[model samples]
Target: MASSDEEKLSQQKEILNLQSQEVDEEYSKLSAILPWDKFSNWINCMCVITFDLELGQAMELIYPGHIKLTEREKSNICYLSFPDSNSGCMGDTQFSFRIRQCPGRVKPMCASHINYNHNCPVALQIDPGHYFGYVYFRQVRDHTLRRGYFQKSVVIISRLPFHNLFMHMVGVIAPEYFDNGEPSIEVACHDIDQWPTPEAGATLNLPLMGTVLQVRVPSHSDKPGLSQNLVVTTESAFSSPTIMPSVNDSDVFKCLFPILPHIQLIWELVLTGEPVVVMANSPTVCSETVLALVSMILPLRFCSDYRQFFTIHDSEFKEYTSRAQAPPPVILGVTNPFFAKTLQHWPHIVRIGDHVPATSNVKPHKLKKGGSLKTLDSKPGVYTRYKPFLNKDKAVLKRLVQGIQTNRPSEVQSAMLRRHFLEVTQSFMIPLERYVASLMPLLRNISPYKGTPRTRPFDPDEFLKSLDFSGPQLTTGIKGDWIGLYRRFFRCANFEGWYNTRIREVNRKLQLLHLEAMSDADLQSWVSGREEVEVVDLILKIKEKLTTASSNHLPVSKDVGEKLYKQMDAVIYTLPEDLRAVLGSN
Candidate 1:
């Protein structure tokens, strides 16, 4: 009876302890979610810029003017906000870009600075010293206005890639500000200020002027099978918020439909980070086409520089157009006709326009052999005749064409394109991922007494040799000259960035493993075999390793080093009192 009672008491205590821990964890999570900082605003700054007849471009109002900005940054912002005169008589236009932040400026913790790489296998590699700007420009004919034009732009600058969210907010705010003026802008800024910290893959309910918008920021590390469908709802019982599509969900079909036949070649060029130019009739077309081209290699972030809307006034205009050297590896989207003559030296030029049907007299075969074609009237197509390695997916083209004929929803068409690109990108990346994995050293090879084993250097020729046995063709079951494709890809900037990042990651893992092995070692046995001087040298070395690991911000190494320190301290205590005193004196 005594034993049974004792056992019951112990079991009850364990149950209570577990329940207490559960409560503590739940409270911690709640605490993290609540207590929003008053100073943290979703938007870092907002600017209302107008075209000045006398000054060229001027800032009419920079809200919360305390935000420090250099002259160069202000100049770039003002110029980028307004479209050039070439985009003649535009009603309203929206575009997004990234610009380098002012040097040495302290970046605040806001939606833009939130690290999106939490729990990601690979970090979202981007220039951390830049801010992304979403601009909404409006041009109207007004007799009362100076220069007979009312031209202005509302610009939102932030660190977040909330393209769709910012666009939606600006769409409402710009129109209201245009009609009612500064008060409306104040209200919009306040609404954005009240938003919760934009957590990756979390649905947020944002309150805006008697309505609530439900939105989700797409995460870079989103799992393959997870639901990425963005649900946007409003407070009204009869209405819903406009569904904002992400960059990934943007309509590639509309952008690429005119040049569908040459899409494979275009994809290859982009993958290799080739200098390509996209010329379109409108700014909207020009920017969207550039984004669409970049998106075709989904899941693989394009690390090279690209401008969605490149203008003659842009700082890089001269560097990009200089004829003294080969064009830098960049993709530029331009609307001005002047680019046609300036960028003629570029390797690939994609001219986009509305599809024009061929007249009965114009035969496709006859035009193919014409060496002397002299007009822009030549059918819209990719100017370069670059051969594509991978076989083009006929099914994707057929489906997109069928969708157009049947008048399918734009969302549906976008989804189809996203799916196709996701598959294509994954198929291309799988072999590379596998090959890199093979280069890592086995666990048994790691030792506490020796230096960390380095990952084997990547050899292009050796990798190509392994393709026949295990490559994209076998992994994806897709027919292609993948070996040839990779041969070219090796020469590109994207491959270089990917390889460097992967190498760093592998080295980090090796260091972590070495530290863990040292922590698990028998320090007493190690010291027993060494002389006094050798033991002191070992102590100094361990101290140096710990300092280096901590300074480098390597969490795993630091944690293991702590354990190793305790083991070393125990061994030191086991030494003679005279020796311990001598060690302590040093």
Candidate 2:
């Protein structure tokens, strides 16, 4: 009996050993299939991270995947993969996050598959829950281009449906600019269903606005499906409520992440010489989105192009379409007829028209040649290579110049001056001050760049060597101040050197329109008769007289002022229709 018992015990021991060996083999297979080293490399390259709101921890351990940027076939693409857990409770709920890449293709899981597969093609399963963001591609400078190479990095996070997996949250690890310089997202979800309530300090190391990220999660009483508000605070020594707020409250899954990227994309397109037309269907989201996109993105250049089209007429639609023809690659929606006419010409069409479409039809202005009304070119940036604000009436052009000098909107003028200064510095080798002085010839009734036969133009090489911007005081000035200082170096350099610019521009238009030769009596007759003459002869007569008096240092008489006022009043009443449109009724 004893021998039989011993044999049975030995058999039991053998069975235990076999079971242990099977368990070890299975673990080895898991390690091989789910290689930690490869996963770690991905995390390192993309800066992948996860934060636990309930635990107050920024955990970077391997977690379930949603979307990621990865290299494929020597090009970068977004890879969507799910995380499989081998450990503790992932949580009680799950959330799905979606991202849309512009110019970059999205390869999603197969339609039949429940989850994303590593081997399938990229395509998103677009449905109700998917919120979208944009990715823009901009070129970096080589040796010649200034400001070094241009690099864009953006991080976008959209709210998700709830799931309590081992992982809490995931986001793109992009360069700061892509996400407006915020890389990590600290999410504090309130009124969550089934999931554990987040503690006050659970989310740490969040990307701060000024210096430090401060998160406060209020205690929630035991309840399910009750809504909770997420309060986020980012504060620092330099942070203020205006620039950097102390508290931010939001819904459990609300998003305001569209503004940064949309503006960035629009600016990138415009500055790089791309065509963009924005039309929205609805007034709220569509119109606001377009406005927000163009508001601060190169305000001087882009603000005018962001037209609010409530409804479209045939001619207005035609004009809208004409402005979008060729050269710059990017094109937004025009009016109906315009969009329909130019549809075949657009290389890529982004249908945002559904957001903000034309609401009403507008009668198009009648076309005129060499008249007061200025026509926008099929390709903008051309004004006979000499003049700007093209096709403006001589009388109106003169008034615009006078307005720039006498009643200038200082802020707008300053911005315009800064833009011109930057344009010069980007291309010319001379100092900004010298460039303005050279342009003084335009004000002095001479050439824009060169002087007349008797006087020599400002030498570019000599001026380049003479620039003394080495002083710290001079170097510390902002763009507007620098332009102001440049203007101060020249006589009548108001409007940041643009005052004289309008003078030369209007004068050139007069010469081209053959109105410069009109006599004083003939011009007066035309002004009184409303003849749409080639030039504002009275204004030019006054300007030339003013220059002569200045050169001779002669004091002007009160009679001169009276004559000017009388002529202006006569012209104002008989002003061309286009000029009146610009000036508007008092």
C-alpha RMSD between model 2 and the true structure: 31.8
What are the per-residue Cα lDDT tens digits for candidate 1 across 239-318?
85565565235567666666665666678888888888887767667777888888777667677778877778777788
Clashing pairs in 1: 112-159, 112-160
Maximum-lDDT candidate: 1
User: What ranges in model 1 sit over 4 Å off?
Assistant: 1-42, 101-114, 118-126, 225-227, 246-248, 354-379, 533-562, 574-586
lDDT of 2 by residue, 321-427 (tens): 45455424322333233343344343322223222111123111111122111322222111111112112223422432443446554333333333332332222
Alpha carbon lDDT of each predicted model: 0.72, 0.30
Q: lDDT value for candidate 1?
A: 0.72
Which regions in candidate 2 have their CA more than 4 angstroms from the true location? Answer: 1-259, 262-265, 271-273, 279-281, 289-294, 297-306, 310-313, 318-434, 441-586
TM-score of every model? Answer: 0.82, 0.23
What's model 1's TM-score?
0.82
